[model samples]
Target: MIRFDQVSVCYDGTDRPVLRDVDLTVEEGELCLVVGRTGAGKSTLLGTINGLVPHFTGGTLAGRVTVDGRDTALHPPRELADVVGVVGQDPLAGFVTDTVEEELAYAMEQLAIPPDVMRKRVEETLDLLGLADLRHRALSELSGGQQQRVAIGSVLTAHPRVLVLDEPTSALDPTAAEEVLAAVTRLVHDLGVTVVLAEHRLERVVQYADRVVHLTGDGTVTDALPADAFRTASVAPPVVDLGRLAGWDPLPLSVRDARRAAVPLRKRLEGRPAPPARAGGAAAGPLLSARGVVVRYGDVVAVREVSLDLRAGEVTALMGRNGSGKSSLLWALHGAGPRQAGTVRFTDDGAAPGAAPAERAPAPLRGRPGRLLRGHRAEADVGRRRIGLVPQTPTDLLYLETVGAELAQARRESDGRPGLDPRGLLDRFAPGIPDGVHPRDLSEGQKLSLVLAIQLTSAPSVVLLDEPTRGLDYQAKQQLIRIIDDLAAEGRSVVISTHDVEFVAAGADRVVVMAEGDVVADGPTAGVIVASPSFAPQTAKILAPLPYLTVAQVADALAAAGSAR
Candidate 1:
């Protein structure tokens, strides 16, 4: 029910067009998925559906776009609001109401929906999105994933014909992502709602998509069915990659199909072991020790009496369901969040750049109950900046106008010391970012990379990244994996809080799972994730009893086995 004819979009201050000479059509009741690299024009294309591109985000639109028989060029976002509902990459930025329940009803109220209908829709949305428990929680107090659900619910309550979701499942855990996608699929199947979704985590959504829209970095778009699209897709999910690895005919599209084809491959790899692992933590002592830590928000005990230790040269993946206190524990260990009762002891030789060890006293956390990581870290003692954190919303840490300015500011904060060069680090993380472009204008993945550069600029002994893979595509995630490996090799401790199971599978040295403000599981990556059905990656599921977490690992095992089949 959406059509684009000779569409091309160019924004101000950018030389090349973001979308170039494109023609596409999304049929009624079809679940269309947009896939592309980090800087591709996926978001720009989605904005055009509701007339936000040139109409609100000033630039030029040299084509005709229509949704549900109405021309987008002739209408502004408000005029098309009834036909289209959008949830953007940053959910908190789009929130206008104070609480979850209120936000869900705001869109319907604007549409002049009857009070009775609005009330019913809001309740249905709460149950659909699992937000009933959080109905009264302040939007600001909710976790990043919670805010995303609220954003989607806010739009769903309006009953728009077309739903445009940008990275809808990025913040959610594996189970939560599945629930949301399942709900979206039900809408398309039962109510004939057309959905146009763009997501970075392909594994989470690819299985649900009926069609694929690949946004070539050069601006053109490729539309095809799921099988045709993935066959030639530049970045594909693990199941697709596994099908390709096996050279299976009519490449499998889902884990179920892949598992059926995996029988022969399993026999080929029966006796082969998983790839040799690295020296995790190198038997090092704790870099940071937190004991009896507790965090409280009003009457809510966000974190209970929990204790954990971070060893040098280790990459620990913090995982759990949404609001399971993963973020709270990270903050508590960093001494930034509240610690109702705890003793934090630290002994890092390289606490901070150019700071003497004697001056770097291990300062304790706050004694009062309450809570808060993920940004360039600066501590009171030593002025050494021993710890760095990159929080869920990486953009909140950025205030500068351009990417270059952010990099320059990071250097200034760290005194331009060696290994503290933000520019060099950013080049490694995300290359070719323009120096003059505003940081806010950068794509979601690019913004995450920029913040990563800023935080790593301090050369902290311990780096804490919460949901670092939110906006990153598979290629960018691979690059990040390399970075994580390098950080551990340098003897720096790393703790990452994320729900990207595939990411943890491929990169993490260890996995720590939290639930209900307590540590539920902690052990090696494969052992912890493979044992838990809720957290297993597609590869782990497809090749169950094999202990293979990634497709690449499986490929390596086959190659090493010298299997001719």
Candidate 2:
């Protein structure tokens, strides 16, 4: 069992305690979920579990922390390493060795476990987590989810009694996140090890937790069962919401459980009123056009023969694997790179970067007299301001005091009307209650929302979002989709570059799949996703036995199938 008695941790020179009086306990074999909004001390709480909070972090610590009959206050992490295995939020931070096998065996080597035992454990862990095939693969070559699994596997190889994870799935897509979570569940259920995790993707993890440790932004920890914890919390998963509406006893945690609880709901569906038809928005002409665009970086063609038309009021999803040139394509579209070939034109429907009065280039033809060639134009300065680009990382755009301030700064830089309410955009997309807090302290999802809000502040006719849902959870992905839909409905064209195939199918009106710097497929969302040889996750779920993307479409398809039967 792991126990914390009145534990308080304070970073150096900071008057505020990151974690205060965090009294909690997790018995052997118990699966405890630690949940809160961003900067709510969730990471701090997990650090305390593995002795990183006060030990490695150089923090002022108070009170007692006991793990499996050992006092954590007196014992250093090295002394307790054999008993507690910790996987941090960024798995890369914990990686020590180069190869997957070496990484898995490093902890065992530290403990001086016999070579035979180490080898046996490594093989078992690799097979258990589906890393057997990837044993020889370099850490750098694996996807984000695969790397995280390797990190977890390395620690589990030590056979620690307690396992603690911090936002393990935050960096993964839906399918990857599901695989990691399922592996975690198997570890606890089959191996009888105590598991403690801090995660924002409550909709996915909450159903599996035996108990919940709810922490407020103020750094207070309270223990409650899953239902009670969610009841008093600000956020909840979709199943939790469904439970509240249907008044299910003991509230179903997983979708399977929810499905069982929904037997009565299935009956009610027979007479349920049809939803109103979704009226299509007005179609606008292409605002940005790329014709035969080609970009090469030192012999590697990042984009070749890529032609795309960005409509004024639509969201286009650009899908590709890692190193598949999605980012490169976005850069070319934003004029961040020099196109060796082709033409990118900005129409008069939006502010042409070259046409903007603020960006007028002083021009004189090289061969002509200065006075005679003064009216000549330069293409470089003209194209710069026409496109407003939002990069993948939120921190790249955020260096402000509060969420409001960040949006205000964006408005100031924009060509639109000054004094635009940042909160209005945030409320529409995020709708959370962290109104007065610093934008940097928000959750990964919230931070993305704020970044997009700042991007929208420009009121550009064309908005480019790169992996907006990259590090988000299921609910967070839904939020991003809603934001994309809203942006398109407002007649602002959006281009989303992402690996999340599900998001592509659900939110984008059109899908463009790229590989080897070339467009492999481009069509309407359903048409492209369904016909493609490469699998798309969200669409795969619907197409498991039905072909649909949105939940409403799923319902309609089911009804149609039922009537046919």
Candidate 3:
């Protein structure tokens, strides 16, 4: 259904081609998954399927791409729209209609399908993707997960021969991601629809993929079975990694397979205790505290009256379903988002000496206690800007044209302020980004890194990242883990609002699950996540009933046991 022949893509400004003479093919009704590091040409390759690379994106394309027997080079996106359906990372950015039903029918309308057929397909898609209840809902009112489904439905309504998705579930919560992937699998298995998906979170969608397309960071491509591909592939899901760590003959692609092979490993680890919690040092007073925090939008309350403490050396993960107030709570704590009623102040957590709570003073940046801002306005009389926030949309914090300009502005902003070097932080966060590249041009993961570097330049006492690992591959995520660890090591409080359970399992010191604007569960990482099937990571699920949260933990325990014996 889809084929690439000697395809190489190179943008005007960059030196090397994003894709280097790639040759690939996707059979009809096959679910082909594309995996690669950030900015390794995953998006560029996806674009070629529908003629977006050189045609619309203004890059140079050498060789040919054919979708459904039509040459993408000869046919532009609009011409090939009927044959190919594409959904991008940000669904809201692609919506052209106000309501879900209208969005679904919009594509069919453009293709000039009969009114009756469009109506029928819209209803079927609504039921298929489980968006019937949201049919009348406004596109802007939908949650991240809902928006993504609507976006997919909008394309699916057209009944294209091939569907191309770029990081479809990158921004969704775990359950929501499951829903989206389930819908995609239904399209593949039930309807025999061909799908080409590029995703960073391999754990979520790898199980559903019929084939894996790995873009080896050097611009080449490898096509093989999921098992064969991940056997030696640079990137593998937690289950596969666990299988590797346990020396299983064949790496397990899913938790069930891994669990079936983990009987012996489980027995070995049966009596071993999980690592101790890091809550002891966290008891030394909260570097930041919030009480009765409330955030409301019109009549909807995003964050309920929640009181929480953030310790200086703790990495806290705020997790819940989509729109469960994780982001709102993070913003409320950072003194940025709308707070209907609450008190967010920096306490004397030993960082500051003998200072009473300055309720009406300023933001915590200056070590001065300032209550959370009630509305949109930032705190007044702020000292050093102690709390830094990287919002869910990293682009919101970036307005500069070029990356160099953004880094330079961050440097100027923190010139006299005692903070980390912006340039240095950028390299550490995401290396090899050219100085001249436009911030808007960077991939989602790269943009996140730029914003992270910009935010950390303030050297805030507390750092909050909402969905930082959205588009980051395992390699980039590993770098983020190190970054978070380093931040906590420096006695900086870190709060990551994310739905990437594997990321939380590998990096977080504590897990705080929120639902319906309330803190449902809060405790140490393993204790909190291992108890809930919805939030548990793959390794935790594979080694069931046991509290092992990651492969590294299991490896450590086994190594310790071996040495002791």
Best by lDDT: 1
- Model 3 misplaced regions, further than 4 Å: 276-283, 349-384
Ten-residue segment with the worst summed lDDT in candidate 1?
365-374
TM-scores for all predictions: 0.94, 0.70, 0.92
- Stretches off by above 4 angstroms in model 1 are 277-283, 350-384, 563-565
After the best TM-score superposition of candidate 2, give how far the Cα of residue 242 lies from its true spot, in angstroms: 1.8
- 449 Cα displacement, candidate 2 (Å): 5.7
lDDT of 1 by residue, 53-149 (tens): 8888889999899898899889899999999999999998899989999999999889899999989998999999999999999998888888899
- How many times do residue backbones clash in model 3? 3
| Rank by TM-score (best first) | 1, 3, 2
Candidate 2 segments exceeding 4 Å error: 10-20, 56-60, 76-78, 96-143, 271-283, 288-309, 317-461, 469-486, 497-565
Residue 479, model 1, lDDT: 81
Please give the TM-score that candidate 2 achieves against the real structure.
0.70
- For residues 498-560, what per-residue lDDT tens digits would candidate 2 score against the true structure? 756655655777788888789998877767766754434332332233344444443554566
Q: What's model 2's lDDT at 27? A: 85
